[model samples]
Target: MFSLMYETPSSWVQDVEALGTLTLLSDHAHCELKAAATMQALVAKNPTCDSIVRTLPRFAMEELEHFEMVEALLRERGGKLAEQDTSPYADGLHKGSRANRKSLLLDRLILSHIIEARSAERFYLLSEHLQDRELAEFFGSLMPSESAHRIMFLRLAEGLFPAEDVQARTAELRQMEADLISNLPFEARIHSGPKQ
Candidate 1:
């Protein structure tokens, strides 16, 4: 029942091709590791937050599996993983986040929802249009995982605090997330800005 902060534009499918399929696969591989790292980090930061501590490791493992899948595809396509440029898309969202410990956790939890929700939408778009059936199938397969993760984060948020409070904060964060997406310069990455 979760929603994306941003709806990927119709142009993004065509735009993905501009980056070349290899680049897309490589970026996807890198993103999976980043997702895992975030989960591990949350686990570390909130040792006393047993809810996060118990859940994040399992999610991290799932992300690693996704990374492996994308890495395999990248290698198969003659693409080698290399240094990726800093993502303005991520940096911009992070810059607006609150700094206090409690707020950080809440914001991060909500941010996870935003990230997965957006990823789910983009993967669906890519899955629909990717010419190769195998690649399309692979991306298509990720939607369920993305959907689960997105929902899990929101559930955790509600579990941690009052439902109404979480909803209020989520509304604030969601608007910020959408604005962040709409304003950034477009790129071919899955979480990049809206198409120009």
Candidate 2:
């Protein structure tokens, strides 16, 4: 189970229903692309970090594959990827991270872990509740991969930083993530809260 302070309200499914499946699918595709890019960026930023170098590229490829799958789903629904505003949830998390060089990598890893954990949680919710059987099964299939990515980032953080540091920072960021999820207006976006 994800170690978080918040759980998405079941009413979020109603928001998704209002937003439409195509819209959600399009948003999901973008999330996948962003996830892939984030992994590659981490690699670029910390090239000498052996664990990151060895692990993240494979994760990046997996994210790209997920992107393709979501895009295909979007197209099948006659929806192309939509141009959208930056995710306030993700942006808030990054902004909340420590900016100093010493802590940046650890912070990024923790943020990635938080994101993946939330994604896994939401995907599981959608997999169970969505009326579209195909979409439900697709989301269900992704839950394990998302959960794996979450654990990988956490392990990487703990390996690179002191356990105390990792735990404290993860706790801090988890609170921030929970607050963001609780406050952000729900749209079709995967990380949003229920519509006001």
By TM-score, the best candidate is 2
The digit string of per-residue lDDT tens for model 1 on 68-105 reads: 98998889888888689997767877886663235778
Q: Which stretches of candidate 1 lie over 4 Å from their true place?
A: 99-102
Separate clash counts for every candidate: 0, 0
TM-score of each: 0.93, 0.95
- On lDDT, the leading prediction is 2
For residues 44-104, write the lDDT of model 2, one tens digit per residue.
9999999999999999999999999999888988989999788998887877675433587
Model 1 residue 118 CA deviation (Å) reads: 0.5
Q: Model 2 scores what on Cα lDDT?
A: 0.89
